[model samples]
Target chain A: MFLRIDHVGIACHDLEAKIAFFESTFGMTVVSREVNEEQGVREAMLHVADGPNGSSYIQLLEPLSPDSPVGKFLAKRGEGVHHVAFGVPDVAEAMGELGGKGIRLLDERPRHGSMGSSIAFLHPKDVGGMLTELVQAPPPRT
Target chain B: MFLRIDHVGIACHDLEAKIAFFESTFGMTVVSREVNEEQGVREAMLHVADGPNGSSYIQLLEPLSPDSPVGKFLAKRGEGVHHVAFGVPDVAEAMGELGGKGIRLLDERPRHGSMGSSIAFLHPKDVGGMLTELVQAPPPRT
Candidate 1:
C-alpha cells in the first residue's frame, strides 16, 4: 500500500533555471541535487512544505541524454510533469501485489532512485496516461 | 506560501470508472464527490494517504459538457493529468504575486472550486506546459 506522495517529477530542459524559477517564484527550497546515470538524468528535489507524511518534494529532472526516457518525454511533451511518485512501505511488495493486474511494470525489481530510495515505474499507457512511480525510502542508518 | 500538494487533478471521461480504478487498483479512499457547475465538472477526491500537512487527494474530473474546460482537455489530450493543485493559505494573494511575473492566471479572483475551496489556475503556456492550480481549503465548521 502507499503511505503518501513521495514527489512529483517535472521534466525540464534547463534544470538550474527551473530550480531558480521555483525558488524565486514559489519560494521553495532546493534540498538536494544529484546525477542518476542509470536513470540518465541530473535531478534536484525542491522541498515544497512539511506534511504529516513528511516533506513532499517537487523533483526537477533534466535528462543526461536525448535518448533517455526523460529526454524523450521532454521532446514529445515539451517541459511539464513527467510522473507522479507515491511513497510505499516497500516497492517489492507493492510490485508483487500489482503483478497480473493488467498493469505493466517498468522494472522487475526495485531499482535505485534519487536520494537513495528504491523505485519502480508503471507504464503510462497502463495507468491512464500518467507515468506513476512507486518509491520506498532507504532504510535508516543504524 | 504553499503548504503541500492538495491534489493532482486527473481528467476522465467516466468519473465512476476512474473512481473505481483508484479504489481497487491503488486502494485509495473516496473522501468526497461533488459537482461544480461553475467549473462544469463532476469531481471526486480520492484520499491517497494521510501526511504531515494533513492529506493529499487525487481528484478525478469529468466534464459536464463538451465545451467545458475538462471536456476540451479530454478531447485534445485524452485522459491524463489536468493540473497539480498546491495548497495555499490564500489563493488571491498567490494570484497577486504570480501576476505580471510572466505567469498568466486564469482567475483574477478566487473562484468556487469543488468542496467550497477557492481555486485559481495558471496558464500552461506560461508554465512550461504544466497547468498548475492554487487551492485554499474550506474553513472548518464551527
Candidate 2:
C-alpha cells in the first residue's frame, strides 16, 4: 500500500547549487548524500517536511556520465523533475498488484535504490506520462 | 516557510480515465473536483496520503481549450507532471522573499486558485525548469 510521498527526484547540473537554493529558499536541509555509480548519479536527499509515515525529501540528482538516464533526460529536456517517488509498505507487493492490474513497469522486480531501499519504476507511458518510482524502506528498528 | 507538499499537478487528456487509474491503481480517492474556466481546465484533486501539516494530493488537470496553458503544455510535451505546489503560511511574504532572492515569478501577485487558496507561480526558467506554485489557504475553522 502507498504510505506517503517519499521524495521528488529533481535532475540538476549542479547538486550543490540546487541544495543551496533549496536550503536558503525553502528551508530544506540535506540529510544524506551519495554517489551511485550503478545509476551514474550523485544525489543528495534534502529533508523537506514530515509526512504521515516519514519525512518527505527533495532528491537532487546530478549525472555522473553523459550516457546515464539522468544525463539523457537533461540533454533532451534540460534540468527538471526526473521522477516522483512514493513510499510503500512493500515494494514487491505493490509492484505485483500494479502489474496484475495491467500497468506497465520499467522494473519488473524491486531493485536496489539509494538510502537502503528497494525500489521499482513504473513506466511513464502507463502512468500518465510521469516517471513514478515505488520505494520500500527497511522496517524501522525497535 | 514551506509547510508540506500540497499537491503535484499532473496534465492529462481525460480527467475521468486518469482519476480511475489513480483510484484503482494507487487506491486514491477524489476529494475535490472543479472546472476552473479562468485557468481553462477541469481538475480533480485525489487524496493520496496525509502529511504533518496537511494531506498531499494528486491534482489531475484536463485542458478545456486548445489555447489554454495546460493545453499548450500537452500539445508541446504531451501529458506529464505539470507543477509542484507547496503549502505556505503566507503567499505574499513567500513571493516577496523569493523575488528578493532573484527568482523570476510567473505571477507578480498571488491569484485565486482552486480550493479557494491564494496561489502564485514561479517561472520554470528560474526553478530548474520545473514549474512551481506556492499556495496559502484560508485558516481552518475551529
Candidate 3:
C-alpha cells in the first residue's frame, strides 16, 4: 500500500527554464540534483511548500543523451508529466506484491534514486498504460 | 495563484477498467462522476485517501466519441495521465492574473466541472509544457 504521493515527474526540453518557471510560479525550492546515466536523465528535485505530505517533490527531468528515456519521452510527448510516484514503505515488498498480481515491472530490483531513496519503475503496459514509480524512503537518520 | 492540487487526470481507453484498477488498488471511493458531452468524455472522480488538504483526487476519463479530446490523448500517448489540476480561490481571478502574464488559456472562460466546480484549463505550451487545470470550489452549504 502507498502512504502518499512521493513526487510528480515532469519531462522538459530545457531543464533550467522549466525549473525557473516552477520556482517563480509556485515558490518551489531545489532539494537535490543528479545525473543518472543509466536512465539518461539529468534531474533536479524541487520541494513544494505546504505540500500534501511532509514533503512533496517536483522532479524535473532532462534527457542526458539522444537515446535516453527522457529524450524519447520528450520526442514523442514534447514536454509533459512523465509519471507519478507513490511512496511505499518498502520498495521490494511493493514490487513483489505488484508482480504477484501479474504486473510487469520496468525495474526488477530497486535502484538508487535522488535523496537516498530506493526506487523501482513499473511498466506502463501492465499498469493500464500508466507509467508508475515506487519510492521507498530510507531509514531515519540518527 | 494555485491553492493546492485539485486532481490528476488520467486518460483511459476503457474508463470502467481503469476506474476499477485504481479503486481496487488504492481503495479509493468515487466522490463524483459526470459526462461532458462537449469534451466528448465520461469522467469519474476517485478521492485519494489521506491526502493533503482533502483535495487529492484521481480523475479517470474515457472518450465518449472517437473525436473527443481524451480520444486524441489516448491516440497519442496511450492510457496515461493527461493533465494536473490545481485548486484556485477564484477561477476568473486566476485566469485573469495568469492571462495578464501571457499564459495561454486552453478554455479562455470558466466551465462547469464535476461537483459544481468552476474550471478553466491552461495549455501546456505556455505552462512549461505541462497541461494545467484551475478549479474554483463551490461554496459550502449552510
Candidate 4:
C-alpha cells in the first residue's frame, strides 16, 4: 500500500543549476547527491519540508548519457517533472497487486533505486500519462 | 517561504475515471470535490498520506471548456501532471519576494484558488520548465 509521496522527480539538463534555483528561491537544500550509473543519471535530492510520514524531497535528475532513459526523456520532453514516487511498505508486493489488477508496469519486479530504496515504475499509459514510481524504503537501522 | 507540498495537479479528461483509478489502485479516498468556473475545471482532491506539515493530495483536474487553460494543456500535451503547488504562509508576501528576485510570475498577485487557498503560478521557463504554484491556505477558524 502507498504510504506517502517520497519525492517528485524533475528532469533537468543541469542538476547544479536546478538545485541552485530551488535553494535560492524556495529555501531548500540538497541533502544528498549521487551518480546512479545503472539509471544513467546524476541526481540530487533536495529537502523540502517534513511530513508526518517523512520528509518530502525534490529530486533533480540529469542524464549521464544521451541514450539513457532519462536522456531520452529529456530529449523528447525537455526539462520538467518526470515522475512522482510514492513511498510504500513493499515495492514487490505493490507491483504484484497492481499487476494482478490489470495495470501495466514498466518494472515487473522491484529493483534498486536512488536513496537505498527498492523501486518499480508503472507505465504512463496506464496511469493517465503520468510516470508513477512505487518506492519501498530500506529498513531502519537497528 | 514554502511550508510544504500541498498537492500535485493532475490533468485528466475524465475526473471520475481518474478518481476511480486512484481509489482502486492506491486505496485513497476523495476528501473534497468542486468545480471552479473561473478556472473552468472540475477537480477532486484525494488524501494520500499525512506529513508533519499536513496531508498531501493528488488533485484530479478536468477542464470544463476546450478553451480553458487545462483544456489547452490536455489538447497539446495529453493527460498528465499539470503543476506542483507548494503551501506557503502568505501568498502576497511570497509573491513579492519571488518577484523581487526577478522570477517571472504568471500571476503577479495571489488569486482565489480551489479549496479556499490564495494561489499564484510561476512561469515554467523560469523554473526548469515546471509550472509551479505558491498557495496560502485560508486561516483556521476560531
lDDT of 4 by residue, A56-122 (tens): 7889999999999999999998999999988888888899899999889997578888778899999
lDDT of 4 by residue, B1-142 (tens): 7677788899999999999988998789999899999889999999877766656788999999999999999999999999988888888998899998989999857888877889999998888888999888887779
Model 2 chain B lowest lDDT segment of ten: B48-57
lDDT of 2 by residue, B1-142 (tens): 7788788899999999999989988888999899999789999998878866877788999999979999999999999999988889899999999999999988878888878889999998888788999988867888
Per-candidate TM-scores read 0.96, 0.96, 0.90, 0.97
Q: Could you give the CAPRI-style class of model 1?
A: medium
Model 2 misplaced regions, further than 4 Å: none
Q: What share of the true interface contacts does candidate 4 keep?
A: 0.79
Q: Please report, in order, the local distance difference test score of every candidate based on alpha carbons.
A: 0.87, 0.89, 0.80, 0.88
lDDT of 2: 0.89
Please give, as one word, the docking class of candidate 4: medium
Candidates 3 and 4 compared: the better one by TM-score is 4
- Candidate that scores best on DockQ: 4
Give me the displacement of residue B42 in model 1, in angstroms: 1.3
Answer with 3 or 4, whichever has the higher lDDT. 4
Native-interface RMSD of candidate 3: 2.8
lDDT by residue (A1-142, candidate 3, tens digit) is 7666667799998888888887776556788989887788889998742543435577999998768888988888788888888778789998998888777888879998878899999988776666889899888799
- The residue pairs in collision within model 2 are none
DockQ of predicted candidate 2: 0.75
Fnat across every predicted model, in order = 0.70, 0.70, 0.40, 0.79
- Tens digit of per-residue lDDT, candidate 3, span B1-142: 5555667788888888887887776556788889988778899998753534446577899999777888987887778888888778899988888887778888878998878899999988887677889888889878
lDDT of 2 by residue, A4-85 (tens): 7788899999999988988887778889999989789999998868865877778999999889999999999999999999
Error of 3 at B1 (Å): 3.3
